[model samples]
Target: MTWMDEFWRLNAVFLVILLSFSFQGAHCELVVSPVVPTLVKAAAGSTVTLAVSFSGAPDPTVTWFKENLPVVTWTIDSSSPPDIAPNYRQVLRMRKDGSLTFVNVTRNYTSNYTMKMTKSGLGTAVTYFTLLVFDNIQNVELHLQPDPVKEGIDDFTLQYVMSQGDVEQQMWFFNAKEIKTDSRYSVEQNSLVVRRPKRSDTGQYTVKLENPFSTVETDMNVTVLYGPDEPILEARPDRPFYLSGDSLSLFCQAEGLPQPTAVWVFGGENLSHDGVLNLTNVQTSQGGNYTCMVLNGQTKEQRQKNMTLNVYERPSGNPVCSVQSVNRNTGLQYHCLWWGGTPLAWLSFPALSNTSSGAGNFNLTVTTSDNLNRKTITCVAVHPVEQNQCNVTASSPVDFLPAVRTTFDLGEGKIVVTIQCVSEASPEAVVSWSKGSEAVISGSTYQISNNTTQLEIRYYNVSSFLLQKYACTCLNPLGSRRREIQLRGPSISDFRLFPNQARTVVTLTWEVPPASVVTGFDIQMKGPNLPSENHNGSQIRGSSNKYRTIQLKPGSARSADVFNLDPDSTYRFRVVPKARITEGKPSEVQILGPGGGLSGPAIAGIAAGIPCSLLFLLLLGGFIYLCVYCNKNKSSRQTRYPVSRAVEKAITAQPDSTPHNLLTGGLKSPPDYNRLHQTPSDRSVALPTFVPPQPVRVATTV
Candidate 1:
């Protein structure tokens, strides 16, 4: 067993030596710093190096491929320069080390790169590089969803968009601070999502896009639209009530994304449009509920708050106190009043210790036995602003402001006299009238009206009415008063004016009745030329050549003659009698001048017919004488002589002596003296022929 085992072991050792020698001669030991399949990144349109190093070969070949297609190749100690593919000829570069480099790299140059090192007698070594050519991070923009984010009601997103570059990592920053993902915040591929945005989250947001070669960032401002919180209203001087003429101010506060605006409403109308409300000199009419409303225009939200205010005022003046009689003049009532206030004033009597609240008037009653005469009474008025008082004195019933008035009217041949009396007293007075100790009653002659305050007396004869003496009495419970009144008569009658033959003198005459109460007479004469003295020895002047006045004593005669009158001028005379109480009406008369009557031609004709008239009269007389002589018996003689006697009487009668007839010419026919004293009715059977007098015309030698 030893000889056969020994022979096989020698042959196996010899075979292991021979195999080790062959492996050593066939392959070299090649080494590389990095393992195969390494990853590399680059940005587009920029310079990059796919860095790799090997220590086994001195001259190694580096080759770059894009998707398994060769782009470029470089080798040291080569007769020709490095070779670049037609697509990458202008942008391919080679470094001194065994690493691949690219100038102005593009996205299309992303692929695997293989490096192989080989020498004449050494074994070849190979390494791989996985290249990722990414475009530069450019055109980075941050966009917000919904444009404007809403608080508490909307989900918002912040996203980034790029045009050419790729991103390896994405980050979000809020106001320069990093944002973390949570339940409310989520990070997607290139966006950050917020579940529900809030007002506190409103600010600037930044987003970053990162890769191996470059990083790009973009910023955007985010605004959260929120609701206007419940509005808070406050008053400057907080109070439930305010006095009149006081100033007030109000403020409203709210919060929102867009600044909120406030409006003040009062009495169903808008008052202010800002946060502050101002009122100067407030009044009672302005008291009511005031509402403050806040609005957010962006969020379309509104809130409101309300407050109430009250205004008060005091009475304008003091209280008034007065006393009046009541219960048939048996008792007295004291009254107090206060007026003009927002709320009713409170009135009271300090002396009586009585109060009447929430009212403006108070009254107290007492009997006459209380002895309140000439005593002072006080009334107090209480109000929110101030208190005031007034005083009054009580007095007994007495007459005051006593007055009497009298007037006269004449119409329809009747005279009326009205007498009125007035008197004032605390207790109303009773009025009574009497005429000469006789009570005046309402009858045909006397009329009483106006609660016996006016008395009217009617009479047909003015002479009888003037003789009455009326007395008016006003009586009350305390005292009595009386007034006396007397009336005057009317004008005088039968006023006449007489002119003498020369027309140079005139006489004025008037008569007063026996019942008249005349004291004197005032005679006024108006003419072209007046006299210097009257017939009664009274003086008169003609200074103005227009008029003159003469006054006579009561006992003087009724007739007055004016001397030194103009012969060619006319005159007018007026006489007014003065009575003890009043003046009578005036009586007027006019006296004509010398040439005021008949024309000159008529006078001449009358003178010419005088001779013919005398001749006719002579023949008529002769016939009458013959008839009388032939009738010798008594009866025959009486009958024939009646005509003759009448003729004789007409020739021998004198002119009338009255001033009226003397001023004018005498009557054209003779008047019967027997019928002068008879009335027209009594003398109807044997009426006398009356001829009116013609105006006097004196003969002038021209």
Candidate 2:
């Protein structure tokens, strides 16, 4: 095969491999950088880091060493390296890229570091790092104390610090034996806390200081310091509300002879260096307890305090409610709502339907059937504050069906009436009956029949005149209605007014009572008034039954305008209402237009009383409502709730007691202040001493 043919065949084979790769992730390749770099200024107990690049794999292996003595190998991970002391002393960090680090390196660990790349082919490449170790990073320091700073846990804080350093300074805590990196003995910043304590943490501890130039070892005594009592965490504002960038002060009160050093922690990270803690911008995440620790070779102590941080947010604007009428007969329901920073909960109805609206709203619904007139509903929003709550109320208009208070009686009759006619009109209506323009007497001879607005002349009426002309009139302000009486005996002339349209078929004339025989003369008419055809008003039919009523010559007029009409007509018609509780007295005849005739005194008295009775009913309703209000709230008259009880107590608490001190002494024991220096004897070195020297020289010569 030609070269091209062979290449194509190989290429085809590769395609099959590529398809397999699609189903599975590609295997990873390991790559390392600074293949031949010279590392500088590496400090002890601190990491000198480099990069490890990888591709196409689940996990990559990176093994590092200095001069092959196996200082430390990062064989399993892409990031973390285990502690191993070696002759050449190498620390390998397994990472694809950033934050690749050497944790807690020692001065003795400096040498040429070589990295091996083993991927896809034991691909081996060696990199040279000229390691430089140093001991002089000015800003680093360390101290040992009780780990949690509590009175109980054996662990203590081992603090090491550099006043100023080029990079982060790592710290390691090791007793005479092995490395224990469990939480009981872990490292934070430059301090090692022995959380899970063992007696092994009490031996001669060694602290190694390293830089790229040299490494220094400091011997330490991890003696047990009596841990402090539990710390009381305190603050000026017990319930804290903090704005961004505001100055907030928090203090930890711990029980110890020497004052405890305080460290603030947030989001699991420590905010302390050289015993100084500062907060710049406050956020909700900044809330937490602060730990104060105190320690030396002999004494260790700590305290923790809780501080709350609140972020301020404005309340939502007033809420709007919507109401609609479903069925007017049922009633109205009002909805109220508002939004705020703090979550709002269930709503309440402190006001009755008649009282209107209430304060402090969440979402409230009131059952009220609105009268067709638009009703205004009010809603209020309330939220919690320190001592008192804040509330804002607003009103909006709503529509609902009003309670129907129509005077509910319909006069029943033998006549057919459509009840539907009442609902279709704007105002309600009333029904009555009349004959030849005269309203019929409501009694046995002229009774109503059927179940509704129907009227029937008594079938028992032996009087044949019962079959005379009559009308059924339904009255209302929107309109008025009257039907022509169905004539029974003969054709009758009927007329009515317009706006006040009625045609009275009868004219009136009454017997002049002989100043004696008059029992209030009966001047009855065929209808509500005198007829327009006065003289011909008298109808003569077959017997008295067919005779239509006629006007009394003395009392009649040509027009039906007899009501309130004067000089032209002298007659007026009136009917006493049938009594429900009392027998109604008959009405007396009255003449219009102020002649020698006037309305009877009884009629005038009845007219004046109708309005006065209505006022009495209103006053009665008001008195009943007042009685109910007084009865409902009889005890513990407190109408408002209070909120600041806890805040008041925190202000009255006491301040803490702890001493402030700095100790300077010998490395192993306390210094004796009384005998720090021995006085030099001034009377010394006498002639005796010179003579003894001369004698000794002569004896040696002999």
Candidate that scores best on lDDT? 1
lDDT of each: 0.67, 0.40
**lDDT (Cα, tens digit) per residue for candidate 1, span 68-146:** 7777677755666778887777877765665667888777777777766555465666677777888668998888998
RMSD of each: 22.7, 57.2
Candidate 2 structure, TM-score to reference = 0.21
lDDT of 1: 0.67
For all predicted structures, in order, the TM-scores are 0.35, 0.21
Candidate 1 has a TM-score of 0.35
Off by over 4 Å in 1: 1-37, 45-130, 312-702
Q: What is the lDDT of residue 84 in candidate 1?
A: 80
Tens digit of per-residue lDDT, candidate 2, span 171-245: 464654544567566755555666645433456665555544445455567544343446565544445465445
Candidate 1 lDDT at 680 equals 36
